[model samples]
Target: MHPVLFEVIGLPISPYGLLIALGMLTGIWVAKRRGRAIGIPEEAVYDTVFWGVLLGFVGARIAFVLVNFGAFLRDPLPLVFSREGFVFLGGFLAALPVIAVVLRRWRVRYLAMADLLAPSLALAHAFGRMGCFFAGCCYGGVCDRPWAVRFPRIIDWRRGPVDLAEAEFTPGGAIYHGVDRVGDVVGSPAFYDQVKHGQLDWSDTASLAVHPVQLYDVAIQLGLFALLSWMWWRRRTLHGQIFLLYLWLYAASRIVLELFRGDLERGLWFGGWVSTSQLISGGLIVVALGLTLQRRRLFAPASEPAAAPRDPGDA
Candidate 1:
């Protein structure tokens, strides 16, 4: 996987960051177009998209760092200032209340607005999954299938069993000078000819073959977007149902997809039996189910008033 897509002068353009930004822009554009079509004010769309994205990005970063607190504690600046490790669940959950507040303040129907935004969110997420593919985070468990991809830069030995001395002496493993098994090279060459040949790269990284979960995520999210869009088109008379359906479908999808995830930072409960996203998805599914049923009942045709009782004598 290519972490750094390229460099402009001295500045690096990360595919992860670039793609996330592009996805946000696309989502915003969709919201604006749909809001206008629904007769919503342009200002409302702008306010919601702008603030929601900003806050959501912050929330995503904060959630990721908090979940992986121990690692960040050692050297906090890299994670704090860098544009990686943004958790989608954190962003989605955080954006909901903010968007709700914005809509409520504007006196707009929150459910209708949510419906308009649902497909956009899915579309953006599809792109974000592509970003993850390039950046190599959110990787899946190792697999030997034909579709299983090998990320040459993402080695499997970062915190795994490592003998530094072996890395130094193993020809093309990694070179170290004045460090032992733990980077205490006694008298190894500072730079080997292979280093110039690009044999060794960013030291901590390792290469391993893993499932291409990113592609799987993209496929599912795009499919969800299409489904939501179609539902919105067909059920224009229905308010909130489309969004609820989206939540239910997306939550179900996330639960299944988390099973393939190999990243350790995503919280795992019950000794790794249930993932954090899976738990959230389960909760969302229950909530959406209840809301869907309730909303449908509220919108359903009322039962005909019971016929006026007639006195048996009169009959």
Candidate 2:
């Protein structure tokens, strides 16, 4: 809920963008602090996170647009610049090589560096899913369950994604105030007092009470973050195992969670029986398992007993 946190000098700074920025900042800060403990310089951590995040953000947005090309093709300018839609997998994978190069250039152990940053990445991603909850993009299927929640005015029957054809925007080219907010820009908070909340009266035209998969995503991702943090504290996992475990656990959870997802813009295949993320997750699971088998050691003292000369899959 609460997509638009508040207007900043008449420009709406969406909760989506704000939470993403916060996730990036907090994630980098935590990674940097952790980096210092392991002999990585603060400046190096800063640079690594900066370039990785920059590339990740751009890649995620581009991946979203690429998957939903039809929508972007009609009138792509607004969505192209807007900091709304993103694909986590795209962002995560996109940054892997960049971070690897950064670690190599900075003379840091690549696998260990990935292990150090894994927890921070999970934590940041958990927050980003919460941002999706606020924005109501990655919504879930309709349900009659007691906890099912509604997102009000998530779509306007009269108007499609954006009425670029009509061209009813402000003098400065911003979206008008009273237009039927469409596409991802719609969606009001789930909880609203009928008698007290006037601005939230979009319930009259709201989307049906659904599974609230976004909130479900938040819970699962937080669990993923916790698992990574716990594994890190244990310090018994293999040098690259932490990141591999992240991939495994995340893939496992996502495979299940994607079943409850409702928004259809995300790429799908096999007659909608499988989402793109599910396919990738399935592939990553095998990758994680293979790495685990190859390592044959988890609690080894010297990081990796015998690391591959150059394993890009370490991440």
Candidate 3:
């Protein structure tokens, strides 16, 4: 996982930031193409996208800061200036109003536009999660097994320093270091040697093994995108149905994935059993279901009497 892509002279460029920008560009291009194919005006799509991107960024930053208020208070400048963490739900919520207003101003049908944008959103998320992987921030829990990777750079203060030596050395008729036999390095020559070797250390309180939630999200979003595309192409018969389906599907997948995420600052309902995201996902599911039912009822066809074409005779 290369965080810094390269250095030009003394300046460093972060790969994560670059990948995010690339994702945005790809999303915009996809949306434009989809809009054109669907007979939506290119200018209208651009206008809506501009507003959506702005609001999305603002919403993502705000949500991240609010969730980690304690950390932000300690480092205000980084919280305000750095573009590290982002919450997709926050951005989606903020962009909803912007998209609605744009659609209203242009006299466009909100449901049709939503259908066009759904796939683009999912593709954008796929790339964003890939960026997270490269940045090495959203890492998984530790395991000694083969599939379990050791992030050498990840330090834990509680564990002190890990000694790779097979045995501990005793000092002057007393046992010193390696007493716990649980990778805890107390005062010992081996510990000092590890420090000299530049091995990273961190607090033992930190969870070492965690699920790689980012990859899980990427898979779910990509699947959703495929499903949405199929629905959009096949079922343009009913307006807003595709969008409703998208909301329901994504919310359900997100709720499932939230179970694997261990970084939420606030636990919901149960003691450390539920997360804030799960609660939000539940709300989204309910709203999506209601919308789906409402759309079905509203778009249902009703019989009407045929009218005689006697306009010419009347005239």
Best by TM-score: 2
User: How many clashes in each structure?
Assistant: 10, 2, 15
Q: For model 2, how does the per-residue alpha-carbon lDDT over 1-315 read when each residue is reduced to its tens digit?
A: 556666669766777788878887888888777766557767667878888888998888888788777657755764577557788888877888998878776667677777778888877887888888777677777679999987654333234222232232322332332112444344232322221124333324555677878778778777877887777767545667678788888899999999988666588899999998898889889988888787765434434432224445543
What does candidate 1's lDDT look like per residue over 1-315, in tens digits? Answer: 555665679666767788888988898887788776666666777888888888899888887777667647755654576556787888888888989888766656777778878999999999899988876667786677888875542221223223244355343343321111222111211122223235444352343456789899999999998988887767655667677888988999899988887665567789989987888889998988788778866432212211123345631
Residue 3, model 3: lDDT of 48
Span of 10 residues, lowest total lDDT, candidate 2? 187-196
Q: Estimate TM-scores for all models.
A: 0.77, 0.79, 0.74
Task: Report lDDT per candidate.
Answer: 0.68, 0.68, 0.61
The residue-level lDDT of candidate 2 at 151 comes to 66
Q: Using TM-score as the measure, what is the rank order of every candidate, best first?
A: 2, 1, 3
Candidate 3: list runs displaced more than 4 Å.
8-11, 141-146, 154-209, 264-269, 298-315
